[model samples]
Target: MIEMIEIAPKVLGLRINGKINEEDMEKMLSVCKAKMKDEERIAVYVEVEEIGGISFNALIEDLKFALPNLKRFSKKAVVSDIKWHEPLIKVGDKLFPSIEVRHYNQDQRAEALKWVQE
Candidate 1:
């Protein structure tokens, strides 16, 4: 399941609990694209409960949207229990200098949301 959380202006929040397919990616990209049109840049907060699977089509769509618009993202906060995510985020922070990526434990969801808005 994927749901949008309205946290702040120009900040997009998403909660992902299950498998993500192409349709989910398309829906999210549509909303994000609309937000980008009005705000130019945006921050993101993602709370991941469990990712059962992701379709290859969804991955491709995400890459298409993310590659060219990397600079359009100011910050990203990921909240999950996955241990590897922290190191991955650190690497992402370096690779995408324009976007600051941070990882937070699932218990720190509130803090992640606050930080993403900041």
Candidate 2:
């Protein structure tokens, strides 16, 4: 499941769990684009609590569409218990230097929010 909330004017709080597929990817992208339409700067707090897994094609499509938006966001905080996500986010940081991607433990949700708000 994927859920999103607008925490601030240009900040979005997103949570993802369970198995993500192509349909979920499409919905997520639509939500993000709609939220960011009039905002020049955005911040995202992405929480991955129990992601069963993601489809390979869906993951690729997500990256293709979302990576460019990272440059438009001021900061992005990814909270996850998944080990592989850290390195993946680090790579994303390199790809979009304008946006800061910080990974946090699942328990550190509040801290992640604070970091992005900073």
Candidate 3:
């Protein structure tokens, strides 16, 4: 399941857990686009917990949505217990120099949120 967490004017905070389907991805994309319409540059905070899996269609949608909107994001904070995600985010930081990407363990969720809002 994927749902919106906090709704700051220029920030998008989400909590994603369990399996993610196309509907979930579509809803997230819709909300993101709507938020982007109001704010030029937004900060994103994502908290992932016990992820079962993600559908291929959702993954494809994510790629399609992310590529074009990369420039619209100022900062992204990902909080997850998944160890591999940290390194992947680091790679993304290197690849997308314009956007600041950071990863935190599940325990540091509050810190992640604070940093993203800053």
Candidate 4:
């Protein structure tokens, strides 16, 4: 499941658990775009504690839609226990100069939030 909430004028909080499908990716893209339309400097806090995995097609679509927006965002924080996600996130950080993706333990959510807010 994907849950998204606007925490601040320029910040969005996201929680994802379970497999992500194309529909979910599309929804997330729409939400992000809508929020970014109002705020140029978007920040995202994503928690993926229960996310089992993401489909290959969904991942591709997500990247296609999100990459451009990442450049417009100020920061992005990804909180995940999954180890394999680190490399992908690193690549994303490299691709998006405006965004910084930091992997944090679930317990370090506060620190992660602070880093992104900085």
Q: Give lDDT for model 2.
A: 0.83
Positional deviation of 31 in candidate 1, in angstroms?
A: 0.9
Model 3 steric clash pairs: none
Q: Report the lDDT tens digits of candidate 4 across residue range 9-116.
A: 577788899998888787888887787889867888898968767888889998787665556877888988888888999998887667767889888888988877
Error of 3 at 106 (Å): 2.4
lDDT of 2 by residue, 3-107 (tens): 775677677788888988888888877877877897878788889888778899789988897776666789999999899999999998998888888999978
- The models' CA-based lDDT, in order, is 0.88, 0.83, 0.89, 0.81
| TM-scores vs. true structure, each candidate | 0.92, 0.80, 0.90, 0.79
TM-score of 2: 0.80
Off by over 4 Å in 3: none
List all candidate RMSDs to the true structure. Answer: 1.3, 2.2, 1.4, 2.2
Model 1, range 9-79, lDDT digits (tens) per residue?
Answer: 79988889899999898888888888898998999989888877889999999998899999899999999
- True-vs-predicted CA distance for residue 13, candidate 1, Å: 0.8
Error of 2 at 16 (Å): 1.4
- Compute the lDDT of residue 31 as modeled in candidate 1: 83
- Summarize candidate 3's per-residue lDDT along 13-41 as a digit string, tens digits: 88888999999999988888988999999
